[model samples]
Target: MATRGTQILNPRTGQRSVFLQTAQDTGGALFQMETFHPAHNAAEPEHTHPFQESRCQVLTGTLRFRVGGVERTVKPGEAIVIPPGVAHHFWNDGEVEAHAIQEFRPALNIEDFFVAYFALARDGKLSDGGIPKSVLQLAVLLKAYDRVLRPTNPPRFLQRVLMETLGPVGRLAGYRPDYI
Candidate 1:
């Protein structure tokens, strides 16, 4: 992987700025993803991945994060790795936005999953931390991105619910999946 890897081709594009670019993971994993500020609103919920190990590099902004049972902030230029089966969650909390890349093993098209999740969140049906104007507008932006990117399919009302939930956990639940 020359680092630039493939263009981020995932579902999260509907929200802030998320990318799941395929790359050469140092761990010799199946794919690498570059995403920005992945988070869950009230509707979005916490989740678990049964088999995949995850790694990330924080590019810009701050992310409210959790991995394996611990919570923390991953700052710019910093990187972290999450072992398989370890629960993890995160969200952005900066002025502009946050950028990060993740590595998933085997053949986890994490990109596709995020697209599904955000699409649901935008619809206002996915569970999240209550829909806010920012999130609602974010959903609209995501729909526009979908028109151009076409990541995944999630209903509109689900998006509405994801927005209504309490925190980033709701949005993330749909993204993480069984990797084993």
Candidate 2:
């Protein structure tokens, strides 16, 4: 399980996350972290948390966010709240590194998902766009973290079909669902 002070670095995305209050610390009420995002960092894939709400408070530099198709630039001391099941993505286009305090309500296994995803990146198993290079790996990760994260494109039903079909094959090929 995640604990305060645990850190994960993703070189592919030039981002680092340090856990502040984990599920254990918060009695499953919230998961909090401090994220360091380098300048010009790429935005994450448009996605949604099916059952969790997220909030991010900018600490330094500027962060750009696209929430539910609306774009906004957030600066220091500003915060953005993303409701559950909303499609959103964020990036840092400023010349300086950006920092933010992020929180997720109804703490789930988000930290585990991050650890697994970043591990793949650290192991050089992800592409330049921060996606798993292998279809099997992608299936495994997507299937495992479906409740916490879901890609916005390709449609939800399509994703479900693919994950349901390929997930078993990926697991049979020795790709376990939980990397952490």
Candidate 3:
């Protein structure tokens, strides 16, 4: 079971997330949390979830989001919903920290994903931006998780092929599907 205050750090974006609810606590219905993202940092590259929908509500500071090719800035009390399979990315472009609540529907293994990702970062296995320095490591980790990166450079198809090819290598290197 996950507690209300379980926190995870994302070194790539310099954000700290506190879990407000977990899949176990909600019987797999939802996963919810508040993220404290540092200024001028992007939380993640554009990505998509094949099996989950997301809702984000800004609580403090300002957040910039690019959803389906449209970019916008959201402030306190603002919210946005991202349907499954939609390409989206967010960041805190403001001077102050950005606090926002994010919820995922039909929670899968996101909690575990966060745990493993943060652990890798803490172990110095990842770059300063929180990305694994090794391509194999990144492929293995991403393949084991739900979210898929949609890289704009090098074309999406090529990236997908690389991920598919490297996934098995990553597993062979002893990466598991989930950390929790």
lDDT, each prediction:
0.48, 0.89, 0.78
Tens digits of per-residue lDDT, candidate 1, 1-180, equal 123333322233223433343423443345555665434321123444545666778887767777656888888889888766665667675565677766666534444544444545555534334222344444443432322222122454654454345224423443222111
- Would you list the clashing residue pairs of candidate 2? none
Of the candidates shown, which would achieve the greatest lDDT relative to the real structure?
2
By TM-score: ranked, best first: 2, 3, 1
Q: Report the CA-based lDDT of candidate 3 relative to the real structure.
A: 0.78
Q: Which wins on lDDT, candidate 2 or candidate 3?
A: 2
User: Using TM-score as the measure, which candidate wins?
Assistant: 2
Show where candidate 1 strays beyond 4 Å: 1-14, 17-29, 38-44, 129-180
Model 3 residue 96 CA deviation in Å: 1.1
Residue 26, model 3: lDDT of 91
Model 2, which residues run further than 4 Å from truth?
none
Q: Can you write out model 2's per-residue Cα lDDT over 26-74, one digit (the tens) per residue? A: 8889999999999999887889999999999999999999999999999
Compute the lDDT of residue 45 as modeled in candidate 2: 81
TM-score of 3: 0.84
Give the better candidate number (1 or 3) by TM-score. 3
